[model samples]
Target: MTVGASVKQTLANLKGAQGTLRTYSIKVQDESARSIYAEALMTTNKVIDDLNKRLKTIELEEPQYRAY
Candidate 1:
């Protein structure tokens, strides 16, 4: 696949992981486990945000990728 497509796929996977982390954070009874999941979720969120910005820049730089 193209670079843009690969990045988009990675972003989607990260988002799915974030959702799973959210669920785990809420459902688990162990306080330590919950805290760990929360921290991981926060880190994933930051990466997602940075990747989204990078995707925007990619789209801007390569108009052809905007539709994908």
Candidate 2:
């Protein structure tokens, strides 16, 4: 697979992980566990944002093709 495709796949996986973390945080009764999950969620979100920015940069740097 190409770098772009790999990055996109990673972004999707990270988003899924973030959603799972959020759900776990809400369901867990232990305060510590909740806090840990929340922290993880925050980190995952940051990573996702970074990946998106990088993807945008990559898209801008790569050439586009058009068929006339």
Each model's lDDT: 0.92, 0.83
TM-score of model number 1: 0.93
Indicate the residue-level lDDT of 54 in model 2. Answer: 88
* Per-residue lDDT over 1-68 for candidate 2, one digit per residue giving the tens place of the 0 to 100 score: 65776888899888988888899999999999999999998899889989999888777776352111
TM-score of each: 0.93, 0.89
lDDT measured at residue 43 in model 2 versus the true structure, 0 to 100: 92
Q: Any runs in candidate 1 off by more than 4 Å, and if so which?
A: none
Backbone clash pairs in model 1 (N, Cα, C under 3 Å; residues 3+ apart or in different chains), count: 0
Candidate 1 residue-wise lDDT, 1-68, digit = tens: 76777899999999998999999999999999999999999999999999999988888899876764
Clashes of each: 0, 0
